[model samples]
Target: MDKFSDMTLFVSIVKNQGLAAAGRELGLSPATVTARLQALEDRYSVKLLNRSTRHISLTDAGAMYHQACLEIIDSVQETENLLQTGTKEVRGSLKISAPRDIGKQFISPLISEFADQYPDVVPYLYLNDNLSNLAESGLDIVIRYGELADSNLISRKLASSRRVLCASPDYLARKGTPITPQDLAHHDCLTMVRSNEELKTWHFQDSEQHNVITVVPKRCSDDGEVIRQWALDGAGIALKSILDVQEDIKQQRLVTLLNGYMKNFNASTSATGADLNVIYMSRQYQPKRIRLFVDYLIERFQQL
Candidate 1:
């Protein structure tokens, strides 16, 4: 039996979740896939999977072996890609995930420009604020903001955007502009919500002081774009990324408030890191397509 071939087949079976599905992916019949799996188990003298009529699951030993197989397969593929000349002419499907507001306003244009430069490469963009499963979703990279909760993934800083406290001129005219962090108690603040829960706490900081203020939410949404729209519509004050609201501030549509107290607040509703980042799983070798895309993003975002 070819152990490497079986390892590839086994990993595909797990990812695809069935023998027939794995067979379809590998261009083999279900019988052939089953035969190869049996050969692998026999060679090792241990059952690697628990199979029923309708489904299959990995055994404890199978889970451990699958991780080792992934590393080995990745190394071999990297070696093969390294031997291929003309890495400069990148060509392949590149899948990426990014936040909705940034993705539409910034990343979509970047992808279009990159595609124009490298017409041979295809791009797929998935927009969501939720953290994605990279390996399971087969994503090449994810552009994230603020602190990452998952420590297993690799992250690189792309750029940083300062946080700002701002309100529309109309709203400030109606409710009065706040001059200090403590004055937020009297204003209606448009808050950000995640998973149906409103994030009511806002953090502010200066050289000598740090203040945490809990405000009543006038409106809230899981989408950052929605919250931004609310602020633009003169709903109430909001803490927002300078990148997202820079044009509005420049146009005087929104007035930045409590500037003296916002030096270190970092725009995140929670006091987490607010640097924009591009993240991916640690790999033995990154494909040229993925590497080129990352470099292109860094170049474009640095200009912003």
Candidate 2:
């Protein structure tokens, strides 16, 4: 029955969500995948999946067996890697996820260089503004900014950037600059809406003291790039990472506002600052490809 082959096919089908998709991944026809799965089921005297034209769902026993298959596959891969690469270089695909803007501007270039150095390894870069679950998504690493909420994932800080409150010179000139956190209510402040219902509130601290204040914005957006663009076009003031606005600020396209009130706070809205982190699931950390990619990222960030 080629038990290991059947198990691999089953796991791939579960991960891909359908026989056709799994078959495509394995370079087999959908009928072949179905036949193999049916064979495995008959041999075990148990149904592993609830199959339909549109979707496939796992039975309770199938779920347990699937997990065991994953562990077995990982162990076998580890053994092969250890025996084949005694002193050889790391070689495998590295899947990474990061925020869209930062990934395009910062991480992509680093990855390009890494790929050049490790020609045998392929990189799968997934860029999105939304947070992705590393374990579920099968990503080797995830780069995130701000404070992390998932304690189960291991994180290593790569770099730091402060959030700055600023506006276009034209906007400040026409609408008078704010001098205090409370004065933001009187200004046309641009807000970032991260999700369907959650808007990013501007947080601030006293320049000389530890007092903090949270201010709601009069204008909002789901895209940080959109808000930054609006800020450049003299639409409203925005609180954004220094990395995004540094070039414009240097060119005098934008002007800093309420300098005395823009203070560091906490993970949610602290003005104090945020650190960019490289995170991964604990179980995959020992893999050669994972370890090499992480070290490469750390080294690149250090140079930056």
Q: What is the C-alpha lDDT profile of model 2 across 1-304, one tens digit per residue?
A: 5778887898788867788989999999988988888888888899889888997777867766775675567667767777888754667778888876678788899999988988878899987656765534556689877776777678888877777888998998899988777787778878766556434445565535544445566677666677888999999888877777778899999987766654433424453237778988655326677788898889888887
Count of clashing residue pairs in every prediction: 0, 6
lDDT of 1 at 214: 82
Provide the lDDT at 102 for model 1: 85
Question: If scored against the real structure, what TM-score would every candidate get?
Answer: 0.74, 0.74
lDDT of each: 0.79, 0.75
For residues 1-304, write the lDDT of model 1, one tens digit per residue: 5788888898889877788999999899999999999888888899888899887777867765765676677666656655785344567678889877888899999999999988978999988777665554456789977777666578887878667888899998899988788898899888877666677878787778678888888887777788788899999988787777888889998888888765333344443477788997676556677788899999988898
Worst ten-residue run, lDDT, model 1? Answer: 263-272
Model 1 misplaced regions, further than 4 Å: 1-89, 148-151, 263-272
